[model samples]
Target chain A: MSPTREEIAKLASSPAHEARLLCRHNLVDTTSGLAGDYVQANLVILPSAYADDFRMLCARNPVPCPILGATPVGNPKRIIPDACISSDKDDFDIRTDFPCYHVFSTIESDGKKKVIIEKKTNLLNDWTDDHIGFLIGCSFSFEQALSQRGLRLCHQEDNKVVAMYQTKIPLLPAGIFHGSGFVVSMRTFQPEEVELVRDITRPYLAAHGEPVAWGWDGAQSIGVEDINKVNYGDAQTIREGEIPVFWGCGVTPQFAVEKALERDAIKGTVMSHQPGRMLVTDWKIVDFLKYTQEQLGLSR
Target chain B: MSPTREEIAKLASSPAHEARLLCRHNLVDTTSGLAGDYVQANLVILPSAYADDFRMLCARNPVPCPILGATPVGNPKRIIPDACISSDKDDFDIRTDFPCYHVFSTIESDGKKKVIIEKKTNLLNDWTDDHIGFLIGCSFSFEQALSQRGLRLCHQEDNKVVAMYQTKIPLLPAGIFHGSGFVVSMRTFQPEEVELVRDITRPYLAAHGEPVAWGWDGAQSIGVEDINKVNYGDAQTIREGEIPVFWGCGVTPQFAVEKALERDAIKGTVMSHQPGRMLVTDWKIVDFLKYTQEQLGLSR
Candidate 1:
């Protein structure tokens, strides 16, 4: 069954530590929706052979594909365990906690494994030791951050997906993976409130927060008319005399994965979140500082 | 004539604000080559009738149309002056600072107006009490910031112009003006340095900073492949393995202005930085708090 909003909101507002337990105890179906205060990451399950290229792509394009963590070859229990997930997939019983898992059978063709994973899947026994897991940052972190200011997400109001679009913008290609920049969902407000909203979200870009773009200044998508007509989610309402603002979204990884479809083998059984919910963890948003890599002694 | 790089860069890094003083004195054709430390801004000389809508557009899209400062109706100087040139566009001299001005007699029609005069001409005659001048942020700030980081701007390195592309991403239509997202020049980097580049740049998006987008991500009208085939500047050696990183560029306003061309309007001429260096101000990069009107307690 599809998830409900209240259930998702409840899960999102819950404490991160508790949220992890829900996923760990097999009480949730892919903590896609439960943690509102935290970041939701897209997961990619690949073989160790493809790991290096994927890692470089993340390094090359961190925004659309930030590396939250990844399991070591043959070990599913930890991926930057000190900072990322508390434990490995098996430890949390992820197979059940996630609403479902998509099982992929890599068919080798030519020198490369021809990736033919489609929308159809059942819990097959193909999951194995060769499987490597990767967690990518979600665009929802910005949405959750924005929600703290009492702004209403259109999806919350309409029970629809966030409006997303396919843009002419291309994603940085990594080994076997290429992504296209998609349409950013836009929210409109009265002309007077443009700066108000831009100001509210500036802190998240950097501790040195600055508004990237605003109004016509920041609204660098296709024109609003085309954007409104083409949407991945329901369009939001704009009061008379209001302008629209857009932000870089988290769905970027999805784009990244799609771009790689022809070349790379992608087997991601994305964990689902409760409606309005995401996985809230003990992770502090600021702790993911670029400067702290040395402190953490982690190699990129 | 357009400004040269060595001349522009020298003027920019110079301790003397003479380039501005020359423009202020109605001494130069345009201030394009005069200073480098500060940001160059586009001057929108609008009548009151078009002011509100234009303001809304700028506020909605801050990056493409950043509003650095604006004057009260009939006032030539704004409270916060454009940091690129001297604050005194009205009193100092607009006629000569720019190589030439594209006068739109009626901002609504994008109608052309006859050139009133040139450098050494009295702008006091054209600067009427009914006119309001608005200064919008230009790209020079980021360009200079990038050059300072040792990243060779392709245009300067290859002695070519920075390439621009029109994108499927469109701007929100505001009143009579319409525009699309920009296709900016790309810079290739070693895959690893992307984060460092983005971080050092965080403070400049607003007064503080903004996030950087990777060019290789599709649909943004830029990518590593496009780096070679269609660039504004002469393509440089990306070094066998550098990944190209892209940023939301100032050139966005150039496209916005171009699309708004179908109508007669209060348009700011494209003030392409002729190697236009910004007028570095007393503002230290660190003190940049990314303040908004609300944060400053000035907004109602």
Candidate 2:
């Protein structure tokens, strides 16, 4: 059965500590369709100065790079008085919670043309006071939005990955971190309902409104041409009247970080699970704001 | 000079009689950047039955179709007693907002495609007692978020159209009305700032978070493979050390609506503007929500 608001709330409020531990221990591998209603995220940890720039970047770009919480300088859990919830009160450690980890290192002597992107394991030991843990929001939230709207998720049906592509769309960069553009994820829907789908999701982009494009033939779709060959997941079948829509993906930053992963920019930390897995905070946005409200003594 | 908060307030809070004048005499033109504080939306007047399904779709997807207000069947103004924003003093007609209009004829059929994907400009005379007007949030709101965050908009800077892309993502489909997946708009920023950009915007999309991808090597960025040949809008330059960031754009629905038009899903209606330009309302989100005290709601 699908998780309910009540069950999800309980998990967020209590036992979530164990829940994350369970996931980390591989006791719970698929957070994919579980412990929902709580916010999940994409994790990217880096050094402090880069952390500062990255934080600003998330601030500038927002939507994807949501920082759930940040650890203090050299401290694993930089305690924020009010987190989403208190149940499994986050020890605020980026070192754990995440079941999987990808530690990245940049090679100094590699020629620009011969550059290769590689990843290792976790980086708990080489911790620097400058390290920053950034938790980003995912399309998973949109998945919830879709489910609420009764839109069937094809990936669930096909038991496949959400089709993602590298779009020509460029992204905002900061500091020495000159990065490339985003690799957007795409989903298909009937052409007729395109507006209906757009109307429903756009405002949901935090009132920014949704979708950058729709209805255009997919064959010619590319911000920077020839990028279609690269993909993170397999593509799905496009129906007779189906129109493909593209969204900015979280991989945008990882690509950016890769470019900026200079020796000075060199820093490492554990990577979070796929976009589906999130650290359910004890706080719902409404309640999260309400809690912040009480803390600030908001009279109303 | 840029409009001030007080000036904007004065204009937004002006009596309906005067606000209507802005509509008349084509005064609302040069609306390129007006009332950035509030929402401006596309106005679509349609028959009531189609309105029902559209409403269902909107309700199903509140993110893109945030129903700020609606007009009664016979009411020329949306400030109807039974309307959503009945108390909003900005009660005005949708007829005059846009500089142009397009009327759809159910009989105007080109059997070739049986549907079309273009904006309708006029059809007020065809309005029946059963017509309804839809008010949706637009990209102007997020432009505020972007402009305030120091993420310079290439559009605003060059006085050009925002770069957009048509991609593989699809919108969620609805009855007679198909939906879209993710639509992305492009913006550029340096790499390190990417995280901050994402962080700032995450809370807003707490429901969905933000962009799906971030990339570094343009080739690997977006997981796709392209940029030069875009789906829409002119391409901009990426400076020596900058990365491009993508976000959800309001045009997602426009494509859907056009596709619907082409398909005759429900004779498209064109009253004024696109979905994202929200009608500046009497209430601001910050004033209504108490959580914006920090950083004065700018996320600085």
Candidate 3:
């Protein structure tokens, strides 16, 4: 039997492990509202040979691809002993903890490369001992903080996936992960409320920090031709006088993988969380922000 | 011919290209005083196979291994056309531009790995098409900014190389570059002047911004047993009431290379700039700081 609305709402405030269990059982379709206080991550898994280059790509373009933590080679368990974060002791499994995963594979025949993407309920069949997983910071990790400060996210109000778009801004190329552009998540805020929103989001550095651009002019500057259409997720209502603010999105690596496959740069399988469905990690947002601040030497 | 003191002083304020030419001729022993307004870089060159791991290692340890820029595979000419920083148009050659280079090769026989470090005037003899060079930011980039505010550095005052130490602080390892610890450069400051000194250096994010540790207790915490005995550079006098302040050093990568070789992780040669002898690039320090601020989304 399917869970009722009341049952799902109760799961929204549940602990991270409970939410993860829901995902493991394939009972949760989207992790956006579940475990609202815990950290949510975008998953990207690749062969160990390609892991270093992907890590560098994320490092070079930190705004678009902030890494919360990475799993050791052949290890799917989410445990970072020295991170001092809440997630260090969780009985987590990367392959089965997410509701859905997208797998991409490339085939080279007669000097031509073709990419095939397939959807799966879990990654158990595709995972290998030579693979490494990266948990990239997701914008959803900061949504709770915004709501606590009286800011209403358009997607949550409408019960839709956050709107994501591919932009003209190019990421710094690293190794074979080259020729990719930036991807951003969009939200509409009143002109007067934009500054307060920026102030609140600036502290969540791991969650893409402040908006990279805002206003109608801002959207055009990043080369988003149509605000009504998005590359991923659902579009939200843009009320009159409400400008769209764009923050770097974690979907960037997915786009990067596609671009790399198009250029024949990758020859193996790549896996990622389906957009809007994230891995509910044991980390608390506050702890992640504090850890990031200390790493950047911004802490007192 | 050896240049006079007055000529060397004049060369300090000269353009970056002129200073690079001096180093190209092996006329300058060290790049500390030359090109005061320009950026100086620590060089690390390795085979293409090891490039990704090294780059990821640097990314994971940003405080100790901030990358200024990287050269395209097999390209020794320093030209980053789209980097908007001052270095794009200069005729800079990485192999012959530094005063000296250190060549490290590993020999494996009978299941034993032996690392040999050799000194050379240039890298032309050993460099091949498979080599990719990385230019890392050096602390010297911020010394001018500190001096501009009337804060004198101890090493400069004594006309000695900055003291560097291998610390007990382990680095976040990546791929083959595992089991390495941090390396820090030391300087002494009066107790009251440390805060102001930190504020001046903090803005140079790419140049290993701010002190990682300070004072005598801070020294012991990082496992620096004796401040007077140095590992890579000369030690300066620590006056009474003054304490030693430590900054993340670029030498960490070299130490990382040593540790990796010791573990039988690397089987080929590694090339690096001789300590205190850096690559004087076309990039101005001011431009690099501004670019870094914009990238971090901290620019207004």
The candidate maximizing DockQ is 2
Give residue B232's error in model 2 in angstroms.
12
Which digits, one per residue and each the tens of the lDDT, describe model 1 over residues B80-196? 444433333333334334333434332332455332212223344566666666665544445566677777555555554444444443443444455455444455666677656
Sorted into a CAPRI-style docking class, model 2 comes out as incorrect
Model 2 per-residue lDDT tens digits across residues A219-263: 344452332343665566666766677655665567666666542
lDDT tens digits, residue span B1-300, model 2: 434444544655343233334543344432335555443444556666665555544443433344445666656556332432323445455655444444543345545444323343333454556677665544544556667887766666766555666543444344455634445556677788777776655433311224444544532444334655455555666666777666554445555555566566764343434322224443343332233224212223
Which regions in candidate 3 have their CA more than 4 angstroms from the true location?
A1-300, B1-14, B81-90, B107-112
Which candidate's TM-score is highest? 3
Model 3 chain A: weakest 10-residue lDDT segment is: A79-88
Which of the two, 1 or 3, has more TM-score? Answer: 3
Give each model a TM-score.
Answer: 0.45, 0.53, 0.54
Which of the two candidates, 2 or 3, achieves a greater DockQ against the reference?
A: 2
Q: Which residues of candidate 2, in runs, are more than 4 Å off? A: A1-15, A24-40, A46-85, A90-92, A109-123, A126-131, A137-252, A259-300, B1-20, B27-91, B104-110, B113-252, B267-270, B274-299
TM-score winner, 1 or 2: 2
DockQ of 3: 0.02
| Candidate 1 lDDT over residue span A1-300, tens digit each | 533544544544346545655654445543433565555555566666666556645544443355666656555556555555543333343223333343433456677654444432222344467766666665555555556767765555555555555544344444456445533545555667655566554333311122223465445433344546644445555556667666544445545554555444555432222222234444565554333333322233
Chain B of candidate 1 achieves a TM-score of 0.62
